[model samples]
Target: MQLTNRSKQVSNKEMTLAEKMYLPAIVGGLAITISHFFRKKPTIQYPEVKKYLGPIYRGHHILKRDEQGRERCTACGLCAVACPAEAISMVAAERKKGEENLYREEKYAAVYEINMLRCIFCGLCEEACPKQAVYLRHDLMVPVFQERDEVIYGKDRLVENMNDRYIRVANSEVQATPTEPSLTRAAT
Candidate 1:
């Protein structure tokens, strides 16, 4: 006494010898395995062939430098706080009177370091930086490391080189110019 009209028809008929052997099911599985042999493999060979990373792909982190080649990080600790993985650490040092050309701000990061092994490359540090000093490079990726000691990147590796400046694609021309315009009083 079924109450629902959606009940499926049940087969109570005895199965044939070939049907019980499950030869059809076995043949279907074998056919699927053989068909995959002719298909293209999606594996990529590294080192010799680099993968095409998209424009927004976040890679190695960098501490940016101003147009004058002065370190822009002010040791505000905003980036360190924003890092969810707690991979970034830094020590602030007061800029000396004679080192005006080296740092953009009075306070600068003296010991900035990021553990590549712990870092998730989430780019939160870049967003949290008010000075726009911290940025994840889109063009370059962190190299393969066999030893754990090499994964920890210090200020020397994070600092942008003045001779070979890293330029963002969206602001290639803009980055080449000065960060701000000179505001002077006009002669009345």
Candidate 2:
């Protein structure tokens, strides 16, 4: 047995000669094309005129340093472990005597690398860092490389300089706060 709903059936009737000609459809399409032709273009002259990326825009990653210009990374492997893509890898080394100027902690990352091709840049590594040593910065741009090996950033590439913008911001924040004594000022 078949069930019927008494609904109105859609007509599949053949089109008339005028409808088959599609004159209205053609005219409507041409009208749209003509309207767009006179419209103002949204094209940007890139490299000459830069678009503003708002604050909190995440870009390339950088390993941060303490106010004393010492490496903040303890080599705890938290950033590597938190990475969903498994792009991060590092080797921890014990900070030797007189190396206190170089590393903030007893253990430091002797070898730290991040594979750009593998990294999703989800900012998980930045969030997972307990020491605030790793961060995805807005200013820096990660450039394209020819070689796959070139994409894998070592400490030399990943580590930011002492006068880095992020480090300056951190220093300013610490100095601005009344409760916090500026380590950079205290050291000097």
Candidate 3:
């Protein structure tokens, strides 16, 4: 195709009076803006106030206890096996004959460590515990620090007794007699 070299007749255009003044555009914009000023602000100020966490929200790990208040973890290694991140480590020891009251099972974890840096907090380890020895709670209340090494949680940091409400609730639940068809009940 032959190019049309003749400079195409330039089309000249001018803004209409309303467009040129720019007043209508600004007024139209302000009409919508005014509605926002009177409406209640939905924005929640963070840090000043935190939102409510759900009952089962998995935030941080805690070692659980049985009704007798003994450590629930038997160190079965299932938690370590279930950990996709390999965050859990344990040294299991045999419970001597006289130590049955101290340990729930024949084996107990002499040393337990969970590298929080490596842990994704997926709650998989909690699910893997047959004795229900672990859970995540809202009391992930502590602020994290800059040091990575400090994040590794040992057994000492993991165990916690119930707080006021939890203790009352736990005790109430404890006092309630267990019904038949034992598998039907949900623990907590």
> TM per model?
0.69, 0.69, 0.69
lDDT of 1 by residue, 72-133 (tens): 99999998899999999999999999899999989998899999999999999999999999
| Model 1 residue 68 distance off true place after TM-score fit, in angstroms | 0.6
lDDT values, one for every candidate = 0.81, 0.78, 0.70
Each model's Cα RMSD? 12.5, 11.2, 12.7
lDDT per residue, candidate 2, 86-180, as tens digits?
99999999999999999999999999999999998799998999999999875445776899779989999888787644632432222321122
Off by over 4 Å in 3: 1-22, 139-142, 162-188
Flag the better candidate by TM-score, 1 or 2. Answer: 2
lDDT of 3 by residue, 1-188 (tens): 54778757676688789978999989988988998889988665544434444354566677876776667788989999999999999999988888876677788888999888788878898789888787865434334669977887888888756452232122223331112223232323
User: Residue 64: error of model 3 in Å?
Assistant: 0.7
Q: What is the lDDT of residue 79 in candidate 1?
A: 86
